[model samples]
Target: MTDSASLPQDTQSATRPALPVRLKAGCKINLYLRITGVRENGYHELDTLFYPLSEPSDTLDIEEGAAGSGLTLVCERADLCTERNTLHKAWRVFAETTGFRPDLRLTLTKGVPDGAGLGGGSADAAAFLNFLNASAGKVALNDEELNEVAARIGADVPFFLKNVPARATGIGEILVPCEVDLSGFTLLLACPPEHVSTPWAFKAWDDRYANKMDIDATERLTLSAHMFTRPSSRALWLFNSFESVVFAAFPKLRAYKGSLIRHGAAAVVMSGSGASLFALYREMEKAMQASESLMREGVKTFIHHL
Candidate 1:
């Protein structure tokens, strides 16, 4: 066993090339998400396909610490630190699990918009944890262990660790890697400045479905086998259980999706529970044109080909 604390001063001081690990964490769009049922433990059982998109993302950098006891974090956004920071929580859990006595300095460069349903924070945390685990030469935690810790931090963290499109179940932890090809398609993401509480979205869903249609049936068909056959199939299959709940509260988000359709998007849908909406275009030129138009309209937008 390699003891992180007992190494000789000379050995530790012989700088190992700075080891400044930088990782690009991808964002996701919930192509289809269904709230199957509520669990006894209060977590909702869900079925969803987490589609990785070539859009906005956050970058993380980690370097060996000079002399410290706990991890230190600096962020591009000043308000992002403190006890509520997801990266901080990930660092704490990793430190406790590996006993590596890490003196790490982490820097987060935020490009993803806050509360846009793009899983920005989750990506940052997962990337940071992975970088730290690799840097320390510790046994890599399997998917199960990684997800267990991820769920403790946030619902979206585990999905980022997978870093690919997957059909996720059980509060979004169960992953079935999909072989969907999005090579030529470009994604246009537009997010208006706003925030939506996940808990509140769930609560609104319960109220809306109290006497409504069957949610399971509506959601199940969208995730059926036919969805993987073609890119255009996504136009019919795009469904998010939180959309109704979110749209009822924030009508502008719904309008944004409509605008994407009018702007030549093949398919448009809300990314997660609330504000960010995305349009998938068959061509990169069209996507870029739409993104530029949205930016001029004062919406925060990103365009990328996946």
Candidate 2:
């Protein structure tokens, strides 16, 4: 097994003694996720609306490294320091594709929790990719090229490259900018202690709905061009297909959603797959009250005014 230290390196670090660049890796919430279809490659197609969240973000501090240092990653979480991490993979692959390898050291402080369907890892990788491109001088990749590289890194990494409200399709790689005005709404995000594996969640859905795959094709075709425009249709739009299997596997998540609703959330739904639930409120007071109520129950919470 080749460790990170054994990866390729260059002599650019000796001359490029630049200042540390700090970046905030923001998280995203899937306002609605529908598994539209499954491909022959076993990748599930999705029709989901992704809304960027500013609060509950991770921080990345990157600086130029010494000569022949390659890429060194030091994360607050030990497990993320490995080559398997998206950050390391981003650096490695970006270098391989563009040949703009620079010796650098990065320290990541994670505020977003993993395994909570928050897209924390993908956000981090996207941030790092942007950093690399910005610092790449003349060898930088363009927006389209960067997005292709981002997609290769992860299905959702390309979403964070722009980090705005987007409607995603085609295995969550194809992004279409959508207009979602949540100006007066406040989002109360609750993260439970339970950690849900995304792979397990998808497999569970496949097993339970093996025969019902074709049922969603019609809905996807009808709603592919739909936007969050009408107020009356908000209730119908506030849905996640993974909730059926995820809530069944983890009953506490369903109970938490009920708590958020009881505390006066206008709408509550699980973000991506499981382990985290968010509620929207027209009133800031109600959102804060719901946050306090969930916190009292030992759930970690974040309040972001959208």
Candidate 3:
């Protein structure tokens, strides 16, 4: 986990007059990721499609308190429940811009593991913001305003607001609906025992593409709506810009991908700058067998139906 100690201190409260509003924040995998260029604002311009999954989601129970009571967060992972927390950061932005009621608390139940490139933290924040918009009419912000709030928190925050299949650009905030129908497909996600920091991933990306952005002819692959509409097409288009560099660092993860493919996976790609790898299969039995094989290799695995 590239030592979070250096990352800038990057959540919620509870109280009266309402039942706790529980919300589920879905996790996602990038079907394709492309770094088109770097923007002058210091954010990498991206072209990626997000595919949300139902199984691995974090749950949040939010409750509002008296005004000026401030925000409080309760979680098993206190390190992730602080001001640097995306939920806390999103709350700060939303409350400041929208004049939201200050006192709030959130009990966060984390199901999605962090640093897996699943956008778990961003999704948790987005889910809470959705709850605030629907329940707190006094602090109601329109979709446009809400989008801005999400962008302020993280690049992936805005995308998780819609929480469906989307083609995202502009540092991953700009979104357009994309067709990614993975119905009946089985996904086997294997996490090697490690984490890759986002900063490290980006620096690696830049270093790899600095002088020769098209180092790999495959890096310039174009995405189309029709490519994600069916399983066959989706398999053909599966790409992640981080895979080459990341796999070089973690050969076990790379080997896992190859193993899954050999075990009949139609598509296997690193989800992000990942320590986690996901493989899609047409049959659950094949996925199950692959999981057993991976487990024998000491890589943790989970099978999910798409």
lDDT of all the models against the reference?
0.71, 0.82, 0.74
Q: lDDT rank, highest first?
A: 2, 3, 1
Query: Can you write out model 3's per-residue Cα lDDT over 126-245, one digit (the tens) per residue?
Result: 887776665455457777888898989898988887776999987888999878778888989887777888888888877876454433434433322322223322365777777767
lDDT of 2 by residue, 1-306 (tens): 111101112222333224576778889999988777777788998889999898688888877788898889987678889999999899989998899889988888999888899999999998888778766766778788889999999999999988889999999999999999988888899999899999999999889864555556676455432422223113777788788889899999989988888877888889898788889898999888888888888999998887
Ranking by TM-score: 2, 3, 1
Off by over 4 Å in 1: 1-18, 138-143, 210-234, 283-285
Reference-based lDDT, residue 9, model 2 = 20
TM-score per candidate: 0.82, 0.88, 0.84
> 261 in model 2: Cα distance from truth in Å?
0.7
lDDT of 3 at 305: 79
Model 2 TM-score on a 0 to 1 scale: 0.88
**Which tens-of-lDDT digit does each residue in 1-306 have in candidate 1?**
121211121222323224566667768888777676666576777888888764577777767667974777888678997768998899888777766567877777888887778888888887766655554543445557667877788878877776778898888877788877767778787887878877788789868653333346555445433332233224767767777779888877777776777678888877777678878899777787777777776789877667
